[model samples]
Target: MIYTVTLNPSIDYVVYPDEPIQLGQLNRISKHHKYPGGKGINVSRILSELAIESTALGFVGGFTGDFLKQQLQDRAVSTAFVEVEEDTRINVKIKGESETEINGAGPHITPEKQAELVSKFRQLKQGDIVVLAGSKPSGLPGDFYQQLIRLITEKGASFIIDTTGDELMQSLEHQPFLIKPNRDELEELYETVIDSKEAVVQYGRDLLNKGARHVIVSMGKDGAMLFTHEGIYHGSAKPGRLVNSVGAGDSMVAGFTGTFEQTKDIKEAFRYSLACGSATAFSEDLAVKEDIEKVLQTITIKQWEE
Candidate 1:
């Protein structure tokens, strides 16, 4: 089984403005839409699109949480979220001449609630994959993710972590099943400018040497590269107009992890990863199964030689 953890989830409210807005003045929007918003939740939703069953685990509360939960349930995605006292957050995205975002702080998770979420991990067994994504809610210990990694590793299950900065650096020692870092995040991790493909391969190998079992460096329109112990592979899909950027990375992570688990074929997984990401990029929202299939037809993966 695959489990995705989203510690802080939200209802993403996207509003479209009829015209340019003036500061400090009343503005009106032509339309708006709401969707369950969280990195891990996005993965589970993408996995469902691939016909793979996954259970979403995280913290949720109040009416906003209810709306988020219902949204997932309606998509046939299972969730095992811990309820909290305060209501879950609502993130507002205003789309005018430019996009602007206002994110919420989310609910605080008490110790008891934290322990409850940990206990759920105890049930994980070998062959299960746990995807830990996004940031945790406030009030939890900084080592919360580390603790969960220990439990997951002890149970013999593999894990994938998609985060940035120190949290990402810290997880390498446990040897996560996979880690997907975009070009910018990769540069930020090593604190160096990567101006060439050679630099990318060098730094990607550095991540492998640091203990990541598998690493994928996503470079937007430039395509993505996969680094494994055996060799490196590069993948790309036919170019398409970019409609949305949100959730594209999570979709890639889900595509690679889910397909790899089932087929154990790195090339196939990389192909699906590119297709899923491109499909999402070409859609107003996350890609559906049909969209993925359409994009898959344009995907190409080749072994990369240095």
Candidate 2:
């Protein structure tokens, strides 16, 4: 079974203005939306679009948490979130001339609450896939994910991390099954500018050497690269007008994980990853299966040649 963990989930409130924003004045919207927002939750939603079943496990509480749970249930994604004391957060995104965002900090996850989450983690068994993504809530230990990696590794269950910076690097020593780092996050990891394709491949290799079994780097319109122990492969992004990019990366993670779980084909996984991301990028919201299929028709994957 596939399980996704979102430490700090949220409700993304996105608004589109009919006109430009006026300073400190009420702005009417042409349209608006609210969706359960968090990396792992987004992955589960996208996976459902592909007809894959996954259980979403994370911390949720209060009315916002209840709403997030209902949203996922309405989308047919199974969930088993740990209820917390604090309210879940709300992130507002106002889209007008440019995007403006105001994010709320979710409830403080106390150590007791953290232990409750870890207790749930104990249920995972061998051959299960667990996705650990997004940021840590306030008061949680920095090595939280790393510790989970160790526990999951000991259980013979493989896990993937969709995070950046220290949270990512700290978990590397546990040898995560995969890590999805975009080009910018890659640059941040190595602390330098990634100027060329060759550099991208090399930096991916560096992560491979450290501990990651597979390193997939998403390069937006330029497409994405997949570095496995076997060989390097590339997947091209399908061309489309950008609508909203909020869920693109999460879609990529879902696409890769769900496809790979079904077929165990690395190349095919890379293809789906690109197509799924492109699909979400071309839509106002998360892409459905049909959208993904449309983009898939335009994607072409090939082994990278040195």
Q: lDDT tens string, model 1, 1-306?
A: 999999999999999987776779899887999989999999999999999999999999999999989999999899899999899999998887688999999998999999999999999999999999998888999999999999999999999999999999999999998999999999999999998888999999999999999999999998999999999988899999998989999999999999998999988988999999999999988999999999999988888886
**TM-score quality measure for candidate 1:** 0.98
Full-model lDDT for every candidate:
0.94, 0.91
Clash count for candidate 2 is: 0
Candidate 1, run of 10 with poorest lDDT: 16-25
| TM-score on alpha carbons, each prediction | 0.98, 0.97
| 111-215 per-residue lDDT for model 2 (tens digits) | 888888888878889989999999888888888998788889888999999999988998888888889999999999999999888999999998999999989
Total backbone collisions for each predicted model: 0, 0
- Distance from true position, residue 272, model 2, in Å? 0.9
Candidate 2, residue 19: Cα displacement in angstroms equals 2.9
Best by TM-score: 1
